[model samples]
Target: MTEPSTKATPTTAERIRSAFARAGGAMLAVEGLEPAESPVHHLLDDGSFAITVPVDGAVAQLVVSAGQAGVQAVLEMTDYAPLPLREPVRSLVWVRGRLRDVPASEVSALLDLIAAEDPNPALLQVNSGNGDTDRDTRYALLRLEIDSVVVADSTGAESVGLSALLGARPDPFSAMESCWLQHMESAHREVVDRLASRLPVSLRRGRVRPLGLDRYGVQLRVEGDDGDHDVRLPFARPVDDISGLSQAIRVLMGCPFLNGLRARRL
Candidate 1:
């Protein structure tokens, strides 16, 4: 079994990347244009993102025209757990960049590469004149060259640099976070209650819910009469795998001093 280590904290970029990848959809807004909500197709490692839009739609038209002038665009992605927590929104990532159409010749190769990393059936629909023109012409692919990133979550809001955003990797437990959080909420009420007991006396009066879990720590949402509070229960160390995560949880539960650390307003 691997042991947890308290060596490093997750950077803003890693957190943003994780949120971006997990988000099902995002609100894409261009300057001097209406915001359109679309499904996020893929997030490339180089900090570029691909989204699908109607070929003749307002967004597509704007992107094509603005690609020449270098128009500014923003992609807003929200991270929410599938579980029924009081406040399910875990984080928000705002990616600001210039939008442009990928070259026709490169679309297939790009989609193939994205599919190889995170396969989506929708990628198959973006054909380059090999099939029905009607079906293929209905949609277009747009790429955003990421310039700046801003993330808001329990910790707070801050602007992250492009290099940091490009270099960071998502959390090791990103894929399993939703499933584990849902399981804890559904089948482990008693465990949640026990964990809630570790909260401050003033916070104990309200309804406590498990908010999020990561390699670093567990977060709790306390719904008080005044308002809602998010508290992070830091682990003894950083976890990289399931066994290490389990040990961190045990250490958090057993040690009284290891209770919730920073309390941030959500």
Candidate 2:
């Protein structure tokens, strides 16, 4: 199951772990599965994916476990062993068995099937020491560490973790993306909370108003009778312009209750 992320959810160590996970996902997107760019990522094949440590010392591991559809595809690809997922929801799956038996030619259908099951799941191939240099190989997998995140809700439970792939290491952009998200999770909470506190009770939705990062600053979805309104907010002042939040930044600055609030640098 996936878990929710809170203003103060995981510890510092966890943030680093989260960063590693985010990095792996980013890398897989760039290297393994470069689908037409969308809001989400996807992996497109069945192959072995491994993790490696960079000069940064911090590292993590992931396996492309199979899914229900993947189990079937593997069987079709190579006539492999008995396939059974007693309960898919409770376990992780990958394409390892199919990887060993099936050649790249037959793996495409299975990869496409898994992609259909989760169109946006991250997938990628890497160029690490253990990686295969063959330019034509591919694989499909679900990332282990990041499949869960908590939603802002009373249930206080984790969300279902999506499948992701981990291929090679990261590039400059990938590393920066990882660092950016990590920094935001660690530092942006106080800014959003303190700013949110100033708005009228009407502004806050249910007990669970998710933390949204946007172009203005931090946009809030004001749920109401018809639908929801997106209110742009500004970063807490003496602001930290770590990321571009667009118009969301301006509205928060104008909130009457938050007039005196200044963005604090982390």
Candidate 3:
């Protein structure tokens, strides 16, 4: 199979959703509040997120002070390449919205809903403390009502509506992208070298590294003396499973008979 020149790429909404799905943490900036880092957050279907913060921390206090009107906030998540590269950041996703506290009466129900969607252990910390514990160590739940989302990458920045983001699903390969990229960089140097040959002469001159993978294609980062450049190598077609991914990589490497490649368990 030959690689397509004009390869398919993910839609803006899909890209945003995929980035959100993969990010393990976010930097939250709220109006009248100091910027904070939150490692525990769950993206809901409504484009909002349930985040856990210190009960007596600045963010929780702001949520209480801001009241029902909510506070203007932007949660930024950076998508980093799985492999080492000159430019490690692959993309940035900004979730701009209003922040408010979940009512004490409703917090339990909301936590249940979030846990059902994403069962992260950190969620349990919200209720781990008792009145005797330090308030600063106790966690509380807050919600961010997303108004708009913008994803910035090498390609450019694109704004996605809250509704559009809610409708789009993350790439099927998202959960496995990091593992696959790391595998390519460590275990398949020759394959990567062969794939680099497919690039234009100018790009082939640089040190090519695997940057990302999705149902659409594989992204490569070329580090030359000047700077880092990103390029996408679309598969013959989109793939959904390990078998299809292997076939696609083989096609990109121009070695149909390459063997003994063990499939990774997702």
TM-score of each: 0.85, 0.26, 0.91
Instruction: List the RMSD of every prediction in angstroms.
Output: 6.6, 16.1, 3.1
lDDT per prediction?
Answer: 0.74, 0.30, 0.80
Model 2 lDDT tens row, 113-226 = 545644433323322223553434323323212322222222232332222223322122222332333343456555455555655666565321323332223434344554
The superposed Cα distance between candidate 3 and the true structure at residue 13, in angstroms, equals: 1.0
Supply the TM-score for candidate 3: 0.91
Those runs of model 3 whose alpha carbons end farther than 4 Å from true positions after fitting are: 1-5, 127-137, 263-266
Q: Using lDDT, rank the candidates from best to worst.
A: 3, 1, 2
RMSD of 1: 6.6
Candidates 2 and 3 compared by lDDT, better number:
3
lDDT over C-alpha atoms for residue 124 of model 3? 67
Task: Sort every candidate by TM-score, greatest first.
Answer: 3, 1, 2
Model 2: worst 10 consecutive residues (lDDT sum)? 74-83
Off by over 4 Å in 2: 1-41, 44-70, 73-190, 198-247, 255-266
Q: What are the per-model numbers of colliding residue pairs?
A: 0, 49, 0
* Pairs of residues clashing in candidate 1: none
Preferred candidate (lDDT higher): 1 or 3: 3
